[model samples]
Every structure is written in C-alpha cells, then in structure tokens.
Target: MSATEVKLFGKWTYEDVMLSDLSLVDYIAVNKAAQSFLPHTQGRYQMRRFRKALCPIVERLCCSIMMHGRNNGKKLMAVRIVKHAFEIIHLLTDKNPIQVFVDAVKNGGPREDSTRVGSAGVVRRQAVDVSPLRRVNQAIYLICTGARNSAFRNIKSISECLADEIMNAAKESSNSDLAAQLAVSAATFQRMIAQDAWKFLKYMWVNSVASDIPPLTHPWAWGLPVTASLTFSQGYAIKKKACFAAKVSFLHRINEHVLEEFYKDYRVDDAAMHVGESAARVILLH
Candidate 1:
C-alpha cells in the first residue's frame, strides 16, 4: 500500500480512521522493500522523500504526544514508520540509520525566511509551524527505536548523553511547556539508564564475572537487596551472604581498635564513665 493510504490508520490525519494508529502493515512493507535491493542514491532519495511525507504528520501529531495523549493508540505508528524508513536507508546506503535520522531532524525541521505581501505593499514573514514538540518527537522516536536489541551499555550511555543535552536545553529555554517536555524525556532516559546500569552490575555480581561489587572498602554496599535473603535463590546468593559475613567480621575487628583506645584512656571497664565531676565551677556552653 502507498504511504498516503497509511494515514487512514492514524488520527493525525484524523478523518475516518477505521484501524488503529500503530499499524504494522506499512512498516512491514517498508522493511520488505528496503531489505530487497535499491541503489545507495535511490535509497537515500526515498529516505528523504519518506521524511518529507512524514514531517507534517509529526509536526501536527506531536502536540498530542507531548501532552501524553495516545491519539487512540496511533501515536507510535508514525514513529514506527520512520524507524522502518531508516532501516531501509541503512540497508541501501550503509549509513547508521539513527545518525542519519537525527541529522535530518536537526537540519530539516523548520525554516522561517520566506516572506509574502499581506493585503498591501508591506511584506511579512510567514511563521514556521514546526513546533518544539515536533523536534522532541523526532528525538524520542530515534532514541526508542535505537534501544531495541542493542547492547545495554551502548543504549544506556547514549540515553545519558541525550538526557544531559536535553537538560541543558531545558535550562536555557524560555518556553515553559517546551522545557517541561524536554525535562520529561530527560527524566525518562535517566531512569532507563540507571535501571540498565543496575542490570549490568547485577549480572556481573551474580555470575562472579567481577568481584568489584560491595567494593573492597565499603561493607555497606552488600547490605543492599542484591545480596539480601529474598535473592537467596539466585545463583550467587550464597556467595554474596558469605562475603557479607566476612566483611562484617572484618569491620568488627576494626572496631576493636576503638575500644582498645578507650580502655587505655580511662583505665576502667565502665562503658559510660562521666568525664566531669558534678559542678565544681563548671562552665556551660551553648
């Protein structure tokens, strides 16, 4: 089916859509066509063309998406299509698809240099209708699509980088709503990055692939749930508990030094010996 026909499933075009917005057929077609064969230039041309077709749609549809409106579940349909388009371009052009898509989004969004006469001899510049929401949509789409099947470390690092950039932008931006949207995406990516990082560390800990966890210095790290009793059924739970017990013992031995110092100073075994006699001209300090 044609790209034009796919709009029938989307609320962005919102005219009598009988199907859900997140349609799979169009992307399936794009993937099939892309994986088949196309010259580099031809693939690039189609990528650009597909971008043009999808731009206005994203521009209009992203408003709802930014507001957290799902548009009757069609919100992701456009994103999926763009991802497939990128996949096609990668197959045909040997370029990293996310990079290409991100570059296009940065350079291709809006231009406001056009002018026209308005009802008289005076000229006025036409407004660029591509909003911040549109740009955010494009960036989020790229990030989410790139997250699939990729190495967790790679995705986590990229997400952290994007989140930092977005947070910086939010600080400098004047539009409150736009800044809030940027902040939301930044927070989302941060949570994902943190979770992914925890997963990475947890895998290392459980498999004994690395012994750096709980650190050689800090026994406190083992107090967390990774080595907790609930995780006992896990493969490394027994090891974790043993290591924690050892660290606790080590710490207790270290504390003995403190008790030895106190004993030497007081020369008495009383634990809470008062240092001062009852009120022989004692000075009171605030």
Candidate 2:
C-alpha cells in the first residue's frame, strides 16, 4: 500500500464548532433553513445526512440564543455549550452530505427539544443539471472513500485501458507514412504512462481515503504495469515515488471503510517483495 496523494481539487478547510448546548428543536430549524436552498431533486438525496448530522448543531445554536434571551441571568455550563457549538459549526462547514451523517453518528443524535420531520417531504426540493466536472469530482471522492462496486472501479480503470489500447494500435500499424495517424514517440508514450498511471491510481487512492480506509502502503498493493519502460531503472523509481506521494495525500481524506479495505488489499509480504525487487533495483541501478 502506498500513501494516497492529495490533489488540490479535493482539499478542504476544517472549522471548529461546539455541540453541547443545542436542543433537538434548534437542529430541526437549521436543517429547514439549509434545505430551502437546495433544489427538490437534489434535496431528496441530501436530506437524510443533513438531518442526521446538522440538526444537533442547530440545537446548540438555539440553546445559545435562548441563553442570551434570558439576559445572561441563567448560566449554561461550558461543556454543553461548547460541545453543541462545535457540532453546529461542523454541520455548517461540511460540504459533503455523507460526511455530515458520519459526523452526526460520532457526535450522537439530536439533544432535547426534538421535533422530527415526517415524510421527508417537509424539505423543499429543486432540479439542477449535474455537470461533468461535478461527476468527475464525485467519482474521485467515491474512489478515495473505497467504494466496493466492481463496475465503478472498472469505469475508473478505463483510462489505463485506453492508454494501452492506443499504444498497442501505434505499434501494430503498418503504414509508417500515414500522416493522419498521430505518431506517439517512445518518450511521449513513457510520459503518458507516468502521468495517466498516477491519475487513475490517484482516483482509486482518493476513493479509499474518502471511505476512511487507512490506505495501502504495500508497493504491490496495486498491480504493476507490465510495460518494459515501467520495469526500467528510472521508470520504476518514478512510479514508486508517485505511489508514495499519493498515499500521503489520501490519509488527510480518510474514512473508516476505506481504511479497512486498505489493510485488506495491501499485504506486508507482497509489498516487501515488490519494493525490494522493483524499487530497490531501480534506485540502485539508476
């Protein structure tokens, strides 16, 4: 298992909020406000996590309001107030609904003044076109989180497959003078392997991170490219370094399930063998 690389697009800032002071009712109200901004169709997919995770933060904020309303005469304990405050901030700052739900579980459910929303329809919904960029981002997130769908993994694998397909086509083509056929030089092809390999691997790495996986550190955790260039002295070193960088980036985005899978997929024995044979040879010989 290698360190997951953190990419600029996936980074987020963390905020601190207290969770203790909020009562259940306050959370419901805040959720209502946030829900109003989301489109109907999108809301359908988002509400569950929001309700589960963010409601407590609202409750805490409401408690603070109530305390202030009482003219500061009644003192709320710092532990409760601070706890709920953090919860509120956490809910507000969280961009991903799934992450929000996970946070809620860690914080425990809503506090007193509970007002449950029935039928899920209480939240307004809206329609919005999903963009290609958004889809790509989501795919990256899913992979970092270590999602288990084989089909999804296969889809991510397409980039690597395409690169190989193109290279093979170039090699087999008989007409060297064919002007329409783009010529990919050996250096260009190696560069493509170096760049695209990391891209595809990073997506997989990020998915593992998002799922809370510990990350794969073993050198052989992922299958090695069979290309001759990849097995060469400099080529192997580059690949290993790329993998190592990716692993570090991934840890910042860790999710529980992803961590579990990392341990399962990457074994110490395999890693040792691959690193000794591939990485050591590359570094030593080059």
Candidate 3:
C-alpha cells in the first residue's frame, strides 16, 4: 500500500505557534518576520494543488508563527540566547482558512466540498465556499465572481422554476394586487432570462466600446411604488445598457465557456418585447 509508516525523528517542528500572551507590537513584528513563508502562487507546495483538489479536509488550520521576540520593549522574550535569531530563521506557514469555515458551523471542524469535483477525480475542499450565492440580508452580491459565472448559464433554468413559485404564491394570497405585481415581475424575469437575453448579447457586441452606455445599477426602485418602471423602449434601453456592462467585465476573463455566438444571434422578437413593456406600465399605473 501507500507509505503509512510514521517516521518521527525531528527535535523540533516548524509549525504555527499562537502566543496569546504576546503584546500587540511584538505580535505585529513576529507576524511580519515570518510572513515570507506564507504560501503564494510561487512558493506553493507541489502537493498543494493536489491537496486543494484531493485532500479531504473540511476545516483549514489557523496557524500563526511568533514574530516579535527579545528585549527592546514590548513582549520580546524567547529562548534565552537565540530568541531574536530563532524567530528570523523559521517562517510560519499554514493553510489559510477562509470565512466559509468560520461561519459554517458553530463549532467548526474538518469538512468536505461535495459539489467541487475536479476533472482529475479530486475534490477541491480548500478556500472554497459551499454556498456560492446564498443571499445575505436579502442583498445580492451583484459582482460575485463565481456566482455571476454560474448564473450566466443557470439563470434560464432558475427563471423557469420561478414561474411555478409565482403561481404558488398567487394561490396562497387573496390580494389580486399582489398577484398582479408578482405576475408582472415574473414576466419581466422570464423575458430577462430567456427571450431578450439572446438579443441583448447581440446588442452588447455592437456596443462593446460605447462610452454612452450607462453602468447597470438598480434602474427601477424596488422600494417605493415597486411596480413603477420604464416602457418597452426604456426597459430595452436599460437592459441593453446593462448587457454592455456585463460583457465588458466578462471580456477581461473570457474563456471557452463564454458564449462565442454574439455576432451570429441577430434574430430578435419584437412583439413579445412590446407585450412585456405594455404589461409593465399597466402594473405600475394600477
């Protein structure tokens, strides 16, 4: 089998040492002294990528090395003779724990990422959050890198499910006004994710470098008079503007996964777009 025999012979191990008693200034110095050993892309272990992909540890170890040591004020005292020199020679190195594990469980321990299976039959468990886009306080991280990438592909599937959700919510409520608003929102979302998306991509390609296009922010106030929004022309303009912004961001990091058919998909629906516009205004007026 694999080498499972433990050969322990070292007098001392270079490991993460947390000194709770260390003064703030000394702590800062110690942290700086050993910071070079912290792994970056260049100094990574050959097994690191493999470890990130295959190692089945859920919780990362929080390790910090002693920084400030020896007698020029602060809590500077260590191994009698070589205290100062000892700190400089050994750099503190450990797995950097992400906030995902920090908030994962009340008492955090090792865990696995079930969803992150790499192509080489390894599971990437380190520095990855299981919940990519969980809504926090109902505020969406509009610029989440992983979430935004996945959303581009999966939004169509999600919008289809939302139609059923709208119907269920409508059935539960006696409020026709609420039902109407939900219907408008659902229709808007459906048009957003499905039909208009392909057309918008073409618009983006045409206006890729157009400085006149405004950045995509919350155009319609989801707060006061929630239904108040733009007409078909206005809605289309804003959507097209947002599409331009998104494409620009995607361009910086484009890969084979990004859709390459922008110039080809020119056919667009005019009638449905008009219908959506009409419906939106109707909801706002009532």
Candidate 4:
C-alpha cells in the first residue's frame, strides 16, 4: 500500500511485544524519508510531514498484528515497530537525544555510599587584632617624616627603616598586630630595637618633642573623608565655598545648574567632613 493509505492499529501500543510483526525495514524507510524534509521548514509544515511519514509505517505494522494474533511471531514484530516509533518521535521532538541517552545510562548505573553521621557542634571563626600594627605603623611613619619637617633628616631615616621592619613583621604575621607587638617586647625602646623588635620605638619617637616637629594627629589628612552630610542645596553651597578656598574665583561666575551637579559629585558625607569640615558644618547646620 502507498505510505499515505496505511493505518496504525491500537495493539501497537503494548510494551513487551515481539519485533518480527512490525516489519522493521519498511518502518526505517518511511522514517528516513520523513527526516529528510524536516531541515528547511518548521512549525505546522514540520509537524504535518512527520505525522504523514510516521502514520503510514504505524498503520502497516498494526494491520500485520491484527492478522497474526498474539503468537510469538506477531509479538516480536510489534515490539520492533514500537521501538522504531519511539525513535521517530524522539527525532521529531525538541528533546536532545544524546542527553537523554546519557541521562538514562547515568540513572541505571551504580550508586554511591549513603551513611548517616552524628552532628558536630558549631565552630566559631577567630577574630584578628589589627590595632597594634596600625598604632606602630602610624608612629613609625610620623617619626620617619618628622611629622613632615625638613630639619631632622637622620631621625627620619632611622624611623623609615623601623617602619619597613614593622611592615615586614605585619606581612609575616599575616596581619596579626598582636603577634607583632609580642615579637617586640614593650619595655626599654633601645633594648626593643636591639632585639629587632622596633614596635614601641616608633611610639616613643613620636611622643618625643625634642625634634622640634609637630605631630600629625589627623588621619583624614592622608585622604578624603569617608562620609559627610548636607542637604542637596547645602552641599552645593559647600562646594562653592571649597572652590573659593582653592582660589577658583571663576566659580562665582558659573551657572547654578553646573555648580549643583559639581557639588553632587564631590560633596562629602556629614560624618566624614574631614577636609571640608568647616564649610560642611556651616552649610549643614544652617
């Protein structure tokens, strides 16, 4: 019979039937023809072509089964046709056949060991101490720069060397400032340096005012403030003040909109008014 005239019967749906009755060769030929037309088209055209190709093979197999009954010969044929039908469906669907095959293999393979164990108590992470190193380093840098004075060159050089040693200790101790301090005993600054424990040396040098150098107390002098608070309008006013402080006289001549945008970008937080404290304080309070 022609491909379009064949009809699949209901018995073809059985799970464990024989393959011989299904007429495997004819099934393959029809399925091959169906697959060829699937490339250049999609949607309804694809669905129609698949159904047309598959229905005929299914119909012939069904007719064979109905004629032969439930004997071993017919059962074998039915099984083969059902298997072929499954393959055809797989090829036409969106499912990835390779992934499906791999998943099937994995699912059917051996399983890993599954055993229960008693729960352990919760463990807390240890906190690191950083204050000692910060204090020591701050002291060292202060002494080295002689608080940024040009007179005490020798003392500055000695302080810089000590600072370098402290930095190395910090690295070796994995940022453990406490361990660094313990490495260098607290008593007798000269003895501490003799033992290569320059931790307290920087502190001692900083406290000594004999060098006629002022102490650098404000940490904010090193960088911009972290936070500052001012209302939108107040922030703009502070920016204008800072501009004047910097001797930018042209700021008075600039447009208000441009000034507002500039302030929005550079204005510090209320809390971090380190460099702009005076202007920020006046504007925010007012």
Candidate 5:
C-alpha cells in the first residue's frame, strides 16, 4: 500500500495535513517515511547520529510519551494513549488531528535560552538563540511533561490530558509555556543570587589580602600570585594570556622606590608562599 493510503490505527487518515511553519519544516519531520500501524522502530535510528530526526513526528510523540515515571519502556501503552488523544483532538477541533499536533509543536517550542557569558566574576546571563531541532525536541518534551503532570493524582486519563495539552498549546494557552517560562526564570534567579554572593566573597577576599600584606611589601607581591593561581585554576587559554598581560602591567607599575622597599627584607618569597597557601586553602574549602 502507498504511504498516503495507510491509515493510523486503520482509522485517522494522514492526508491534507499541512505544516504551516516554514522555520521548522525541515526539523519537524511529518513525512510518511516511517509510517506504521504501531509506530515502533525498535530503536532503528539509534546507531547513527541525528538520525532520530528522520522518524515520523507522530512516532516521536509516542516515544516522548514513553519517558519518565511508570511510562518508562512502555511503548504500546504510549501508543494507545497517543492514539486516543489524537481521536479526542479530532473530535474537539473537527480538523486534521495531525495538523493540530504540528501546530502545537511549533507554538510550544521555546526560541531563546539564557546562557552565561564572560569570566567567573564578571559573568552575565544573555539570551541565546535555540537550534531548530532543539526547539522541536523541547516543544515535544514540554507538551508530554505538562500532560503527565496534569494527569498526576487526577481523575483524568493521560490521553485526555495529552489531548487537552496539545489543543491548548496549539492555541498558545498551554501550561507548557508557563512551565518553560518559570523554569527559565527560576534558573536565572538562582544564578544571579549565586553571582551576588560570589561578588561579596570576592570583596572580602580583596580586603583580607590587603590587610595580610606585609608593611614594607609591595601590594602586587601578594595580589599577583593569588590572582595568577586563581586564573590558572579556572581560566581558559585566552584568559591565561590575559592574566600574563596583567602580570606584565603590574611589573611595569612597580617603580625603583617600591623595588627597594620590596627587596629590603626579602619578603617577596614569603608573600608568594602565603598567597599559594591561601589559594590552596580556598580551593580545599570550596
């Protein structure tokens, strides 16, 4: 039989269901390449990288439904739930359920994500663009996750919950959007709090270093070793080069008067050791 002739569950027809989203047309993957009655590939695309994108989108939904909690490893159960959900979707919308599902996926996917930039002390969150494949995956994940959460400890069956979730998502009113937004907000809040706490600790560290410096010693003697140690411990190649440049700048800033005072008591070696000990102590505590 031709692919278009095949019916899902020998019932719902996969015809005239168009993907309207141009951006996800390549990644959404709604073709009849893997059309089947059961939607099981037995992990056929697992051997090759990124081959899962070739799997039918409906099969992908079924697979997504099989993840987490009691649903884990239960393919047939997932298939049944998805089939019933599609039936409900068709009943409610009086449209192609597959088209509704595609719309849901396109609408539910997140477009941007918060990411960290710059060095440890100067780090900041910036909104980054998400890949098309990741957007589709995240949309499916959120849809299934919301459905599962809604059905938990409730009278509603998972199929009904899934159907409702998809419908709401298609209309841009799903709890999946709220969940994704809250997740991103919580993560950003936590990171900001952590960064503020680190800044306070860094301020205290600078004060402690200044107070611990010997009276006749140059301030750079104590600060340089500790900074270098920290930089080397946590920095990348470019950061290391920047750290070396900073060391050179500090050396140039040291005048003949400061050098004379610095060499008077031979305290530079002791100061370097103290910095090493302090860095080691902080590392151990961390």
Candidate 6:
C-alpha cells in the first residue's frame, strides 16, 4: 500500500483533514507522503537544514513531548501519550483530530517576537518576524510544554491535559478582552491623575483662605463632591474613544454617587460643563 493508504495508529484517517489557514498551508506539511501509521522520521530531517519543515507535523509534536522530565529520550512513550490525547480530543469535540490539531497550531503560533540588538552595552530590544516553520515548531513546543506543566502537580493525566489545551487553543481567539482591559487601565490612570489634581486643589483651598473658610464638618462634605466631579471630567476626557458602557462602568466603580448625579443633573452631553462649574465653585470660592 502507498503511504496515504495507512491509517494513523490503525484508527484515525487523514483523508479529509485540510489546513483552513491558507497562509500556513505551505509551512504546515500535510500530505499523503507525510502521513503514516508510525510518524517516526528517525532524525533524517535534522541532517539537512530546513528539512525539518518537510517532516510530519505530528512527528514534530511527538518530539516536543519528549523534551523534558521523565519523558526525555522516550519517543515511543511520547507517541503513545499523543495518541491517547488525540483519542480524547476526538471523543470530546467530535471533530477530526488532525483538524483540531492544525487549528491549535494556527492559533497558538506567534507571528512576531523581540530580540536584543546593538553592541557594547547599548543593546535594545527590537521586534522581528518569526519564520513560518519556526512558528509551527514553537506552537507545538508550547502546546506540549503547557500540557506537561499542567499535569505535573494535578491529579489529571497528561492525555486529558493535552486534549484540553488543544481544544481551548482551537477556539476562536479575539482581542475583545484585551481592548476592554485597556479601557479599564486608561480609566484607572485618569483616576490617579484626578486624585493628584484634587489633592493639590485641596491644599490650595485650605492654605489660601484659612480665615475665610470654616473648619470642616464631615469628610465627604466638600472634598468628595469636588473629587468625584473632577474624576468624571478627566476620565471622560481621557476615555472618549472607549465605549459608552465602559465609561459608565468606570464611573460606577469609582463612585456610585457621582454616577447617579451624573444621570440626574446633566445626563451625558452636559457632563463636562457641570463638572467644570462644580469644581470651579469649590476651588474659586476658597
């Protein structure tokens, strides 16, 4: 029989498995010649530079699994572990194991990385493009490494951990969470600036007119109003690009009182005006 006629481990077939990512089609070598029941290439790819890219992707994964701890120098053990993991992936996801594995590689691969450059202690980090072959190699290495680490202390077996990691990686990866985190971070930075500004203004109010202004009544009597108003103004100004829900969420987190008053007094369009006037009255009066 030809190489294509053999099933992987006498069970899974590579018939319909295709690379959905067109850019990675050339880099990820998946074809009849590369598929085999036993994916051992016997280090022939290592004899020539760049020949490793022609090796089967599953063989690369098996080699990565053999990198650390007790699994080191044990190719058959790594192969058995990967085979069991693929079976688990098939049972849970009900999809082709090869397709899931390919998607995981596509999602987990890093496109760019930083390297140190320059000479004589003037070195700086510069971003560099990761070659396609290296990207696939790194992705397999990381997936196997993560599976090993997770299985180290936990009661879960390596096969289960590996299956879970591959399935999670294959899920659609997006930047929506990152964008939300950035919005919150920007709002936090604005709050810090508002706090500093409020402190300076409070100092000026007290020192400039100690005789004109009476002693304080309560802690939130005057300071909180001024601070909240200033925070709203500055945070709104800084987060104009953020979504309206994010802005409201920031305001609600910092001060619910200000948020309620915000809706009651000026709504949204006239918020800056109300905040400016409130702060001016508090600062200019004293």
| Best lDDT among the predictions, by candidate number | 5
TM-score of 3: 0.17
lDDT of 3: 0.29
Off by over 4 Å in 4: 1-132, 147-271, 277-286
- The regions of model 2 sitting more than 4 angstroms off are 1-203, 206-236, 264-286
Any runs in candidate 3 off by more than 4 Å, and if so which?
Answer: 1-178, 199-210, 215-271, 275-286
Every candidate's lDDT: 0.33, 0.32, 0.29, 0.30, 0.65, 0.62
Over 4 Å off in model 1, which ranges? 1-72, 110-286
lDDT of 3 by residue, 67-117 (tens): 223322221221221222222222221221211111211111111121333
Query: What is candidate 5's lDDT per residue for 27-51, written digit by digit as tens?
Result: 7766666555656767686678778
**Candidate 6's TM-score:** 0.59
User: Looking at model 6, how many pairs of residues clash?
Assistant: 0
> Using lDDT as the measure, what is the rank order of every candidate, best first?
5, 6, 1, 2, 4, 3
- lDDT string for model 4 (1-286, tens) is 4444322232122222222313232322233243321111222423553342333322322223332234334544443433443344345543332222212212221121112233567532221222322332332333223212422355543223323323333233323123223222111111212333222223433444423322233223223232366576765555543422222222233456644543455442221222222322232333
Ranking by TM-score: 5, 6, 1, 3, 2, 4
Per-candidate TM vs. native?
0.20, 0.15, 0.17, 0.13, 0.60, 0.59
Backbone clashes in candidate 4 total 19
For residues 1-286, write the lDDT of model 6, one tens digit per residue.
4544767787777888878777778767678778788767686888888888888888888888887676578999889889999999999989988889989888776665545678988974453556778778777876787787788899999988888878877784431112222222333333323334334333444444345333343323333333454676654433332222222222323345544554454343232323333323322232
Using TM-score as the measure, which candidate wins? 5
* lDDT over C-alpha atoms for residue 46 of model 4: 30
Superposed model 6: Cα runs more than 4 Å off: 1-4, 172-286
